[model samples]
Target chain A: MSDRSSARAARAANPDYKILVVDDEPDLERLIRQRMRRHIRSGRYGFEFAGNGIEALEKLVELPDIDIVLSDINMPKMDGLTLLQQIPEVNSDIRSVIVSAYGDMENIRTAMNRGAFDFVTKPIDFADLQVTIDRTLRHLDEWRAALASRDKLVALQNELDVATKIQQSILPDTFPHVDGCEIFGCMEAARNVGGDFFDVIRLDRGCLGLAVADVSDKGVPAALFMMSSRTLLKGAAVGVGDPALVLAEVNDLLNETNDAAMFVTVFYGVYDPSTRVLTFSNGGHNPPLVVHADGSSEELELTGGIALGAVPHFEYGQASVQLQPGDLVVFFTDGVTEAINLANEEFGLETLQALFEDGEARSAREAAEMILQAVREFAGEAPQFDDLTCMTLRVADE
Target chain B: MNVQAEHHDGVLVAKVEGRVDSSNSQDFERQLHEAFGDDAGAVVMDLGQLAYISSAGLRVVLLVAKTLGQRNVGISLCSLSGPVQSVFEISGFNRIIQIHENRTAALAAAGK
Candidate 1:
């Protein structure tokens, strides 16, 4: 159970209720105090006596923490109905329990409409009165608990909003400078915080490191894992010679500390502008699409490996392909192909390949935008379940 | 959501009906806890009539599964409708818990 709910349960179990008892009968106060002597001694309830509704209001003003008002309908200066109406105005948190005659159903109903929380007959049995008091306190506890949870939810949403901003800031806004490459990346989380990350880092010897990854879980835990994984990959990629070796080192590091059993599927590549050659590695990620200048596309199914954090000391494989001028390599997470439409049909790999097959010439940024637009159009009214991320790299004409 | 429970073939079968969204997930959790009690036996969840489930409902199901696991009570889910099955699949819950085709299969799997 969450802290808020547990606290509510505790309050319901042991309540230190304070009640103001108002009545016109002069001897009623002494009788009640005597009847509830054991309760008073135990510190479960503390009482303030009032002869009429007007006096009850005064007591309430002095002690705003008073939780309940036990009052008689017929009083000298003020009636119970009048006090009930005024009680809410002074403090809406206060609940009123009316004392009425045995046959006063009409007045009891009237008192209820006027804001009485509950009622007990004039000839009140002490045992029945005790039960009513306990029941009324239980209701108050639940009401307060609900209010507390509502406030906590508002605060939690604000914190998530700030977290979303922090996650967005972690991504690279500008791609690395590569003479023969134009690169772009975009990420959209289904929730305020998501587990998708992409980066383009300029490595040694004018080589650019490009990566896209998706974590296994959702929300803050996934977001935290994504940050750690992205940081580790970027830290290892800069000094490492091989893309597969970089992933292997990061995988070992993640496996050592991954207590949550969370894993990430990643595609990491290194592009050398001088050779127009791209060396890449895949760790259980979806195969990227390589679209040739002739408007034909092929799924870039490289040597495969399991996702990071699943096993330690696991070997990863590397593959290379030379990119011709005007060729495009588009990388994405499963969220792209698995995107569902209103009809519950996936957008699918065929549709993605078709889009690339018949598309016109565009920059990396424009192409990324077009794909995102198509996904949104396909998803019409269906809710997005996973984080959507995509990256595109185009070889500029020589 | 409405959950009805009955003992059949030496197994507790909980028939869940309607959408188990955030609005009533708390009540649903309470109902499950009340129905299961302290019996460390076999429990079968029949989801043949369940239409939808949200994250809140999933959280409750996880809590119940953990509690029952700790108590050595075997729990299995059966008869998931299409939409609910999709939710379970996407969340990776299908990997952790045992799921069967129907109540009879679930009972047999639980060794009832």
Candidate 2:
């Protein structure tokens, strides 16, 4: 009828479970042990016993699987409540119940406050004790299940964190040290993974390949496509003489198995340090902005072709730009100019070009930072929507 | 930074003040987690009092937003000051995370 009796009935229904009893009185301990053995023999319970809190803790340490502790509040060396405190430190999983002849309100409150499962008066009711054990066991099961799930979630999150780090590591660590070029670049992903990539690769003597690309979509799938496109571009560029031929090969390779309906917009170029010439190809990419030494800037308009993976025989067009001393070229993904500020104003190409007019950025690295800073200033408290990828190349005098 | 949260029309409104940088990113994240964990409702983070935010802070926001996204939870930010708004703009966060000019707008947007 009472809460305690119902709990005992529940435990009696599941008798294979283990419960630990802790008390200092030898006579009382023996009587309790007898009652427990009788219950176990009758298929009503299974029990373990300790004479004091210290011995009880020792038993708990030895057998962590023990499901419940029914303890006396007052004892020698260590009180029942003290043992309860130790249980949480050693293993908070163990549920505890306190039994005492001194059933004062303060003592009961202290025992409960100290994390006791339940408390019983000195004149023990077997029904009440059983009910407490049964309820405690049910709660223990739920707690254990919850803890296991929490552990699993934590493990999964750790794995995701490692994956994110691995994805980042695959990007080029530093810009290639080109003799006649100063480089600056940055990649900002909208998510843990992103689809934009920019890299400068050193080819054979006197040549460096600069690339800025955007995949059709966002997140992990797009990131994978970007990685593949980057690899194929690098591989093809190494052997191909013309930048257009390099992109054609990359597009063909991607188009062959492009089942995800994904495509990439790329501006790939190879600059010759000896000749001060940059031969480039555009595949549905944004026109790159070139800032000359005389404080003039213009967009390098390369005729556009379909994005890579869009068609089997996509023909990319090539163009050439002659870079003199103090000339700079800036290439970026759509994420940059499309970035919206708090007022919903885009950090458009015009803003980016204006930042370059000030002439503060002497090196490519500084140029990249300046552009990024301008975008940051413009967005002003808005959230990022896409991955921002930018690469700047400065031509130095021979 | 100091973060305080209260429930408004079943949505959790988190008020963030001070600078959000590497030093306080963890605290910011913990407060969000606590607020969202309490009620699986829309969250509107008020940033009117925020002075500055670094890339580290940006990362924290992204991480929380992504988590909430996966759970089909809606998150919006309101009342960003000039500096804080710029960081999000440059980082392209403005495009991904919902932003409103004030609390009323953010709350209204979240309702949709």
Candidate 3:
């Protein structure tokens, strides 16, 4: 089918097409009625009459769904070109077709710029009028479809904003106040929702659980997986007091029915301020760095294991490290080190270790902020691709 | 990104030959989903010609893998270049999805 006829067919299921005919000449009404007799007889064209631009505006206000306007260029009260300019103010969706005398090319140009869709010269040709009307109707259909898609996009953006907020709310807002230790954690997603998460959960008898994880994807899917992984880790840690057992159980649980085949790299550590010791296990996560008081820094050693949810019957290996009063342990996802700069260089582990070893970290929060600032500066003008997460714990004297 | 698909021995081999970033990952995902039919026993993505991939591309791969896994179909990757291989390794995606050295190895692993 032709584009015009196809557009008409699509709108045929809707209400009747309405048109406003504006002219000072009373006989013009009779002419339009006679010309559109076939459409009028078939209930396809419904007409509203107006003598001038002011009258047309009044009718348009009354019949807001008037799809088209056929107005004379030189009416007594308000001319058609002025009405064309004003029609958009009433409803930009309404296509205005200017009716001008022959050789009135100047007014037609002005009308076209003023938002007239098309023009039909007087001594109105009925066949030419039909073509313009059909074309205008197709434009209207295209506008409505564009508008519908725009509305859908707006709704989707609103939903994503809410999802981001919900994901943020699920993370720990305030760090637990524990004696002899300072803890702080933060996360930044590349998109509206991120795949990175961190926790500073309070355990029994002055013990704290510190975990930072990165899901292997992005957007909503990663965010969903991150949430479940976060919840499972927290639940498993509280039920069993060991880091290895917690990871082992969480991994097994995720593998039980993980249809997504998604996986997470996590570093889970249980710290006891009373003993100044940390018991931890690594699930293929980036190793956490330790900076001692004497300006020496090194990556902590943990038993090797793969990421969680990838395989069943996997055992998580655990290790322990004694902390000094002035030592700080910094745990981070790969987003920090793998962060690329305009030069395409990564903010590698050595820079992070040097930041702590050089006395840039006076507090846990300061260390986390400084590390993020370093990454941001290093990654200047480059787009972030992954979720960034960090958690820092500093051993303090009692 | 250009994604071409061909079926061989009941396996769907999707050969991606360009960068799959945020701008075109959705289209890449739609094309892959269209290729992943019920009767397709295994899906082998040949990324030998794939120049680069962003997290958005990885997200689509994860989604497709999850859907096919639920349907009891296997998915594998073959012929990743240096940069793409590092990305997969860094994100630990290499551990989750099996990666083969070449298309022949991938098809053999897929039992095609």
Candidate 4:
């Protein structure tokens, strides 16, 4: 119940510190009330009296928010030394200030060894008692603050782990099976959940919709933003023939309340199986590589536009290329090319361009595997900072 | 990353060297802030020696541009080539901010 202690700590007209005073002498309670009257009136301190160790334990159990215990060593039912050991059992955070007689040095040493926070001589000077209470409370404040922040960090980490699982679940794990056309996609996750994601949508008339996007930041915030983008993009792409129009709609929706200033770079394309044509639009994302069955490879041109959610009402344009039988189109996030190595050199677009340049014919799955293997080999032992996602679609023979 | 400021007639040329990624972006932002002043007529970021920049680095540049824009002070960048130039273009940052071929060109067009 540190929570109750914190709430009590914030209230007005309530004591800053609550203390339990235990002593067998019947006059001690009256003397303490008279001595501490100013503290009680100013709301700086509240004192609770207990006749012996047994009464003190009961009082502490009832009012767990009690911060300090001021106890005398010699008592009828139980002594302060025995209560000192058991005080922690009630509340380990409770600081004990032993009230022993002056020159009771042996018992004082034993109390100190037994975990008494501080001690005051028993011809009890109320002034020394106040100083001890103030010092103990100061320490408790620091301890509580540190503990609260640590607890908050632990809770945040646990939530992020859950968020990572939810992010992974939303992505397409199994590519759609198109007759005579092979499709495959893979995402190599980084240590922290990143914003990279890809989706494959099977549309009417044997058409396929594909998307690969990277949100600006990593972790839970990016994951949440990516989820919104994925849902919006999928909904907008349905029954929409124009890739640019779909992106424009999703962008406007995202910018409605995009106060976090986050943005996503997305490449959305739809391929018509009958016409063998692939139409696509880019929102500041890297252009995908296209390889014809004849072994000609080229990058789709870049569109001079910012990532989605940066500017409102910005018109995005669409572009298209005719595909032939056995042609390949590869989509990827920046994590593929920007993957750093031991020399701090990037995997770079040149390496990817070269891989796509190969004249050999490869299936969609084979090409996806080849790209991943190359990136891993290039990175060597370097740590990956972002998730790497790649998707390949190969046009089959007529 | 290293941010070295050189004062010209009416502008401050901040020559940023090395790669600015997520790791040193905060330090990069601090050094860039330290290199420029509110009274300067203009700021020119020389990315000639800059090998690379991630989105985190772009955020620092965006903040500097926005802060200077609000104060009516001029801001521009120069000497971006290859991947760096492409990144600036794709992100559409090239549209909002001015660009020059070199530091001399930026200085000549300073405060315009």
Best by DockQ: 4
lDDT of 4 by residue, A142-249 (tens): 999999999999998988778778788888888888776778888887745778889898888898898989887666667788889999999998956588988899
Deviation (Å) of A1 in candidate 3: 36
Candidate 1 chain A lDDT trough over 10 residues, lowest sum: A6-15
> Which 10-residue window in model 3 chain A sums to the lowest lDDT?
A6-15
True contacts kept of 2: 0.00
Q: What TM-score quantifies how close candidate 2 is to the native fold? A: 0.64
Ranking by lDDT: 3, 4, 1, 2
TM-score of each: 0.75, 0.64, 0.82, 0.80
lDDT tens digits, residue span B35-111, model 4: 98667888999999998887667767877887887798889999986888988887777877888888778878884
Higher-DockQ candidate of 2 and 4? 4
TM-score of 3: 0.82
lDDT of 3 at B3: 80
* Docking band of candidate 2: incorrect
Model 2 over residues A146-203: C-alpha lDDT tens digits? 9999999999778766756776776776877767777778887777777788877778
Better of 2 and 4 by lDDT: 4
Q: Please list the Cα RMSD from the true structure of every candidate, rounded to 1 decimal place.
A: 9.5, 11.9, 6.0, 5.5
lDDT of 3 by residue, B62-103 (tens): 778878888999999999998788667655567678999999
Which docking band does candidate 3 fall into? incorrect
